[model samples]
Target: MLAGLSADYYTRLEQGRERNPSAQVLDALSRALELDADQEMHLYRLARLVPASRGGGGREPVSPMLLQLMDTYAATSAFVLNRTLDILAMNRLAEALFSSFADTDNLVRMVFTDPAGPEFFTEWHRAAQSTVASLRLAVGHDPHDARLTRLVEEISAASPAFRQLWEQGHVRGKTAEAKELLHPDVGRLSLTFQAFDVRDKPGQQLVIYQAQPGSPSDHALKLLESLSANYRDHEDADLP
Candidate 1:
């Protein structure tokens, strides 16, 4: 059915002569391109038709109170992410988790471009799928952000795994779930994660990971905390 599009019509839409497409038209194009849930949402973002009430600003300001809140979780793994999933700040325990990676700050880059991504994540397939979906949700509210745009393009070109997931058009926000990770030092770890939206900042979220009491993961976190007791998150204004 998508093949029925006239060349002129397609060309006009592409050239921006037709700014908005009807829902049926968008759905047909989605089918024509084999767009998945994530890709279909991305298509809508590119078309600039997502409701403005839902789409907020491109960048969120990190509140001082938020940073203070993160400090309270010094022994636990906690971090803040902006709308595009940029790591704005993290507690010491969170920093320890990524101490081995060069791009320790950016979650997406660490997942998609790191040499140890597959092994370290252990559940790479599902993690990648969920990440791509979160990214779709983030961008749906602010697609013109250059940082987000560049990060997506780079990940698409660098990792086929990310590209595949991104095409699915899936969108999901963070939910309470157990995560498993293979630490380079401590081996396997299991932790529960919670994501909280910062109501003051439209796209900011606070995430914390904790292990259940008396679990192997809990013991490992204790060890990790001791090892990184003196570690401090470096301040790098130029860091992206």
Candidate 2:
């Protein structure tokens, strides 16, 4: 009945050491492993002995160039995030821009699970929908990721809003966005957002935001910066 394949064979199949499996074999294996779309693609590639293309300079390690670019945007908010919505890093501007996020690492979690998050987002419904769609896009790129699955389960369990949005099954591509942000310190800031993929990591994104020059938004940004600077100093003094 082929009830089970040996662990050794399964490992070889996953590692691409055993190639040229027939269609029937792959189907059976996929069924056995309960592979999803991305996992199925990975399996097909392995069966064909196709090597995954390397990223530009290799799997991304937070490029120095990107860090330098972020430095140049001191007045604008910017963050580097991988496909799974794991925040890799952020600039001072980003902290001031999305100040609530400074305390949390996961953007998705912040949007759904945090009590203060809803109030922070003026257009909370649209923001929540977009976040779920973006997560679906990430899943399309890497369906086998355990962290992604865990996040989905956690959020789905904790937030009915997340569950509803996720069930809609909307897929999306990376794109620029504009937001009307209302920060406690900044008041209201209309900002333009741009997202760039990290060349070295296929699904990573570098998100940057700029307010239109010479607007009240610019003044609001400065106020947020001053507030954050004051908080930072207070925290430092309280530290042992």
Candidate 3:
């Protein structure tokens, strides 16, 4: 056999009858299937052979230094996300960029379950696919996470599209990509975003969005920034 396993053993493995597969056997199977690094690691997780990498079941606080760094990006949109795509923290511009959503708590929820999602994201289907793929990558890191499990279930129950895409078994982390968004106030925006891992903080990622300088999107971002600032000022004035 390609995996160096007898026919009956492989069949049993496929049928879930073989519960305790050795690391060597998994390695043989991974090699035979030509799995990529992420997929191979996901396989180990599925077999309960790998320990979960995400620590603490609850949300972790964003570092104050990181928060200060985000604040320095006055013209750009920046936010921090946990493994389950929870928006742990956001700068002013980032909050303005997503202000249309009723809840900006989870990226997956924003893309899939939010009523404003489809209209806000110009390329809705592509956004949905990427969001699902990112979540799949997160699952590989911590399959036993209760919050993640609940999120999957809630979205799956509410959205047939989410259910379909999630069943496709795509696994990928968030990567640099161009995003086209339709803002309620500013109209269309074309921006590119990049993701970075927070040092010493496993499962935490910092993402930043920027538009090409001197372009219409760049102007729009500035306008949005001003609008966000004005709105915050008004809210503060009304607090008393």
Candidate 4:
């Protein structure tokens, strides 16, 4: 793991305080580990922090065009999420549709931390497991992402259930699927999920949930709008 460096030097590198590593050394480690593109980048990021270390090679932000594209689909519930499912942005319909998740920007945290998640999900166990598996697949795709590594560690500590699901090493892309959301105000609304690739942002995806026409879900959607307005009104009233 350390190449020709002394054990003490390797410890410093791991600790992120030393910064004298050469690009050659970084490349050597990346190749030695047989790292994929994502993991290789992560190693560079870690090495960049050391003194005399190369600086500022982190991932760029999602492109402005991509943001606009997602926002333009305003009538639908669309969101841009990273491989780790961190919600980067959403349109108004998404905000209204995911009212309960409005408080937290991280989808995984919202799912596992909220007591309402289980109730809202008609297939709670499968949905939860699928999410954990997705995260595991992301780690495999980019083992070098320190942020993702930290997130996994944090969630593992927070929920043993999540840990069990993660260790299973499942990998599957989210696809078109129907879901029944049990909204407190709107009751059960069945919706279909569709996922699209964000062309400019590799490793990021756009997901949308649309209710079928002329269904009970349509009525529930109306009620959800009413509930959302009521909540917003109360929030406005509370503001100074």
Instruction: Output the number of the lDDT-best candidate.
Output: 3
How do the residues 140-229 of candidate 2 rate in per-residue lDDT, one tens digit apiece? 445566778898999999998899889876655447777776777667778877888777666678888888888898878777777877
Shift in Å, residue 228, candidate 1: 0.4
Cα lDDT tens digits, model 3, 53-168, are: 65642479999999999999998999999878899999999999999999999999999989999999999999999999888876766667789899999999999999999999
User: What is model 2's C-alpha RMSD?
Assistant: 9.1
Q: Please name the candidate that would achieve the greatest TM-score relative to the true structure.
A: 3
lDDT of each: 0.78, 0.73, 0.90, 0.70
Which residue segments of model 1 deviate by more than 4 Å?
Answer: 1-59, 230-240
- TM-score order, best first, reads 3, 1, 2, 4
lDDT of 1 by residue, 182-232 (tens): 888777889889998788777678899999989999999888887776443
Q: lDDT score of model 1? A: 0.78
Q: For residues 1-240, write the lDDT of model 4, one tens digit per residue.
A: 446667887788778777778888787776776776645655554455323212211234667877687667634577877778888777666778777654646777877777767787878888888677566656444457787888888888888888888887555566678887877666788898898766656667788888877788876776666666688799999999
Candidate 2 TM-score versus the reference: 0.71
For all predicted structures, in order, the TM-scores are 0.74, 0.71, 0.87, 0.67
What lDDT score goes with residue 182 in model 3?
99
Evaluated against the true structure, the overall lDDT of model 2 is 0.73
Worst 10 residues of 1 by lDDT: 230-239
